[model samples]
Target chain A: MSTADNPIAVLVELRDGAVARPTLEALTLARSLGTPVAVWLGTEPDADAVAQLGEFGAAEVRVAAIGAEARYPAKAGAAIAAATEDASLLLVVSTFLNKEIVTRLAVTTGAGVVVDAAGVEFVDGEVEAFQTVFAATWNVRTRIAGKAIVGVRPNTTTASAAEAPGAASIVPISVQLPATRETVTAVEPVAQIEGVPLAEAPVVVSGGRGTGGDYALVTELAELLGGAVGASRDATDEGWISHEHMVGQTGTTVTPALYVACGISGAVHHRGGMQASGTIVAINMDPDAPIFEICDFGVVGSLFDVLPQAIEAVKAHRGA
Target chain B: MRILVTVKFTPDLQSQRSFTDGTVTRTADDGSMNELDENAVEAALQLVEAAGEGEVYALTVGGADAVAAVRKALQLGANHAIHVNDDAVAGSDVFGTAAVLAAAIRKVHDENPLDLVITGMAALDGLTSMLPTALAAELDWSQLTLASSLEVGDGNATIVRHLPDAHETVTAPLPAVVSVTDELNKPRYPNFKLIMAARKAEVMQWSLADLGVDAASVGAGASRTTVVDASPRPPRAHQQIVTDTGNGGNALAAFLIEKGLA
Candidate 1:
């Protein structure tokens, strides 16, 4: 609902590898209110993002060439301005680097932003975004009129799961690169946890430290559910599970439809990341475990005692 | 380097929260500077140590409560803390906040030719994590995101970006904005000495008027995005209870069968 008369050009920021799921989701949501125009910030994009962006609903993929080292904020802001010249709303992926990109874009474009959205709807002719805040304690539904931007978590939207051939054309940004004030030395890769990332998965089965280094139950349960596996930071820190699967404040925030927390202590930080789940089920020996307090379904028992049955039920439900 | 490190006072990642209809509510018990921001501070501190001749400046925009956040940044090795306090700055969409921060950056640049602007890739409040990018554009600075490793030599910085299963090393000439991901380094905890040092130092506060901005442009009023409603995601359901007779193997089998898994 931008005040200016123009269709929104969803300014998707797509990177080489890690940016796909978010870009796809952004494209899916963009189809609702505007024509998605994906913006790849770098030299020519990888060959894959082309058709993928278009298939996800991007009508055009805009490219902005900046120094290879320029962080997302500069190029992305330039991309938003570049894309918004003929457009209204700009949709960008919510990431640490792109944050300033969107914020700066808003200032230059005189737009607004709805960020880290879980579910978004075009309600009553305006963009109404469902956001998870306060560790998922509150689900805020918001809307914006006039020109605006939306910063979305990766994998929040469900794409058609198909790729279409896309054409990526370079759009040169007039703005020159800013004099950088920070110096980067290097980047080391963290050991990635196994399974699909929480933000990208439809189903997830998680375990707390209660597993006592025995993830057999959680793994079996996740397999039965046909879902990815996740864990509490306690499990990861305890070496019972890896940080890759840890779901907490320092870890990944998940907005899945179904989230199963097993033997978790349910620290608030952990909940902050998982509270946006549609259906949360917790299984712990102590009913008082914090995880159960926020769960949509709480089972007061050892996970060792319950997951088998739940897996069975799920298998039956799936007719597997 | 004359670096500027920006940090945000954020609600404790562990704090339980609920929102009123269409409005998100938070308590005064907000927690630490987001862990990632702490890393930014650490990066700034480390850079200062490496540069040997530069001062570190911590910049922030928030109410009085955020004084703690700026102070923490000071404790991490920042020489000075600057608070941009303006009611107009509240509810600033990333763009508005960036505008004010841009003003602050311009102010800092005007005062002491800045060589670098550093920030966490994103704060725990978990918004669109796009602020760094915007700031870089506004300042027209070279930028780096998700820098995993960093080295400064001969007035140039060589940093590595952590991509999936691999890394990309890139070099940036001096005076750049870098939005560092948490992977860059673990932020060190502030010792008691630094904590007291932070207390002794004055944190300079500036208002919208100080930043030379109009009040109407910031916060929810000028924001294109508005909270329409807020509701706690419904409470979890009472789960079905299941127990075992100390024989996990046998019990597990029976349990699965009862649920029709077997």
Candidate 2:
């Protein structure tokens, strides 16, 4: 197939059997590149998901029926490769699992892969991806020569419905998965956070050493803003919060629309993970906290004092 | 049991990092064994210590400065150290680097079978987190990545992988590749005796030809991507700071309200 006609495959991730917010954003991104072909890795998606994908400009929904084994990267990567044989580029939500799958896919297909991309575009008929590196201090533009797999971070692209939406045709695919030694013995699903997933949350409120092991105010503010609660390495290391909620270079990297750092020192490691946030707001007792340098708005005060008043003001605003 | 742990030398995270000619500028003065690799070395040492009769080989593929990675692993109590340094290996992407690592691993495996290969979750400089998966693909081995906790016995390795959504327990047979997260274990500081011994240890060095990998197929020429442009991101503009007497929360809320971020 010619490059012009080659489809842009968007790997659709599902949460609760529905299209994930990041996948929708990816579909929206794929539509601009070419014909958006939604690639579903597991069992067939219900009609609602198909319709949702279609609304997001997926011209076709290709379901790779790989069953339970699809959770494995080798199996899932093979299925995706089989499904996107004619695709010029593949776009995925840049989670750790998806990065592995795409990396394996790139190895198998000899395609270039770039993950944690802030944006990707076609320049001079070649794919160029924009990403932040070195603790989000540098912006690099990478050009992929041929077939490419770009893992885009959550909240990077706006999820929008197509202007001219239509019914998407579903194409079922069967893949012959290769033999691998890895086996998933068991999966324990963690209890879901009350609101959005941390990575995909539009608003994130993170606490650090100043929380004093008390996440009560942090959780309250996060709930009030419909955001996700996050912790610094200090808090996680102190066993104040689970490691999954830790945001840093070694932990989860979040790109939310609004990132609120409370009493966090904003070490470079922490900054590397969250510096790309759209608008940063920091509340800390220390005026010299590094977070204030990057934050669009900063409040120098104890979070204990600031958060409660902020919470009440937010409530009042919502009520008004 | 035998294990091979891959380590990398990377620029210190605190250093002023920048890219030159589309690649990260490297210097021996500012580079050290990647911070995360300490966890990999620790995991390997613990696994071997538990096995009671096993060896751990620390391997690194890079330029001259990269040998420091394996040396650090040796200081951490690795029984053996191997450094693959070749000019052609410079500027290699993850795929190219994986090819070299896998070839070196195969050479070691041929000498004596390896039970597992362990690596850090990701390199701090690149932070791609793709090398372990790429190495597994290149070696045609099972890949168990992002392990927060791990256990090995009965010819199989089981790992507890903590993800944002779920906690998954994955198992893979021996001869697999596993990448561990920092949550796995606290790395032990090198004792004075081991540190002194590591300083005098002879590191086995090899070239691409020695590993039987063609230099042509694993360098910038073979790379599928090129960095067209790079620059330091300009700082955030119009920053505002407020000292909260009592209305700090009101100001915070008002700021969010004005920005439509609330």
Candidate 3:
């Protein structure tokens, strides 16, 4: 059992004065381990920000904002190390930015760092992280020997608002980072798309080679559901969609609550990424398609015919 | 200028995957250069060719069969190939792997003074994406990772990272580490002549002893984390398949409604 002195520091990434979805999920998970503390990197947490963190059960908020020149990974690591010195564990979202900072922390302190953890728990008074490895073919339960730093995957669990809000207190920190030779000269944001990002979407509709180079039905179904659109390697390789939409071993690993595989033959390579999804539904012309083997519901028919009607049914049902 | 590009020999993603004890079974499937590392090799080749005066060395660490990774790099036009292998290095975790690679990199730098170290975003088998930063920390060098495009000028490396939501350009001075994503470039296929030549390329082999890596500090026992349990994923059972008799869509919707998804 964790005592009140052992807090769990949750890395809260902010954008335009709002906390990101993954950070809220991290706070939810942190609450399960110990007293939740929000670690904000950009600026002091305002009242609104405190309320946002409080909704997810953060007990305190720690803010560290250095000058632009000293805000690299080393500095971030120093700040986290100093702020969470007595905390039992630190939870960070598994984005590239956070991974770099966590790597630096691991090296600087010789602390064990686990990346892309799908679940974290306190087992027998120790932290046990669940990792999906080998294309999700094998699940590994890992325990870090000493101080633990974990990179939790986005959207692993649904974020739920707590009944009672947390009382927020401000903790300040200062760290002098070594001179960095690296600097960012420019940033070009990706073109805005219609749906939510693939990693964060709760429902995902994906297509593959069976789409025959047309993703019209796939896109329509995804948009109607207010979810993200994904593609298989064959679809992305054939130029039917961007590589970013591909879901497979070489591409993004997703664990959405509902994974709709449209016109996709679930190969081992492709299944490795999405096999961990909560529920799977497959639509394909071939009944023998491997996708049907793992799906909770399977429809063997041409997607061109089935998707249109399915979309209509979904729309009509939601309207009622 | 001298550059070192790191690559890995990974199990073919298409093949059936297996695990022995706590480690993955690599030999069960045919292995090749990690698909993503091919882009790193291509990036390194382009930078060297653009400069018109430099050498690209390829390095890898694994079992004996792992040398195939470096050979593939040679076929892709790397000038030198180095393979670090030893029984003691087996089952090395990412941290231990980083320590060994850092040592080998230090040795190579001692001999030729590398100006840049390039790598793939992540190895397909592990997909950790931790090596580049760990390498940079070990060498105390600047790190510019996940670069989708790269350019070298004025003793510095500039990269445009292709993040999911944004493209970020970062620069690091000489003697830094940069990892490139697959979006950087389309890797080229090795011609027949280069393939045949790569078969005969001299692959320098070194061991833990040569690089001063202690046996006790690496391998499974020394790993900070241990895989406590692993089991075969349970097969999906009792799948309900519906053949579209023109009412298939309604059935699927009904199923969704029953599951509370709609």
Mind giving the per-residue lDDT tens digits that candidate 2 earns over B1-262?
7999999999988888988888888778988899999999999999888878899999998889988888899999999999999999877889999999999999999999999999999999999999999999999887889999989989888999987667899898888899999989999999999999999999999999999999999888888888999999999999999999889999999999999877
> What's the distance in Å from true for residue B131, model 1?
1.9
In the range A80-180, model 2's lDDT, one tens digit per residue, is: 99889999799999888898888878888899998999999999889999999998889999999899999999999999999999888888887899887
Q: What is the lDDT of residue B257 in candidate 2?
A: 92
Q: Candidate 2, overall lDDT?
A: 0.91
Q: What's the distance in Å from true for residue B172, model 3?
A: 1.4
- Residues A1-320 of candidate 3: C-alpha lDDT, one tens digit per residue: 12346699898875545787888898888877878988887666678888888889887787777644324677788778767777768999887778888888888777788888998988887788987777666788888877888899878866876668766777777665666677878767777456577877888999998899898889988887778999998898899898889887657778888999999999876887788888899999988888998898999998888888888898889889
lDDT of 1 at A148: 61
Residue A301, candidate 3: C-alpha displacement in angstroms: 2.6
Off by over 4 Å in 1: A1-87, A90-108, A122-125, A152-197, A212-216, A235-244, A285-287, A299-320, B13-32, B50-53, B75-77, B163-166, B214-221, B237-262
Model 3 is docked with a DockQ of 0.66
lDDT of 3 by residue, B1-262 (tens): 6899989988887776667777777772488888889999998888888889999999999998899899999998998999998898887777888888889999999988998899999888888898888889888888989887788889888888766666788888888898988778899999889899999989999999999989899888787777777777776666789999998888888888888887
**Cα RMSD (Å) between model 3 and the true structure?**
2.7
Better of 1 and 3 by TM-score: 3
| Cα RMSD to the true fold for all candidates | 5.5, 1.8, 2.7
Ranking by lDDT: 2, 3, 1
Single out the weakest 10-residue window by summed lDDT for candidate 3 chain B.
Answer: B20-29
Better of 1 and 3 by DockQ: 3
Model 2 regions lying over 4 Å from their true place: A1-4, A317-320
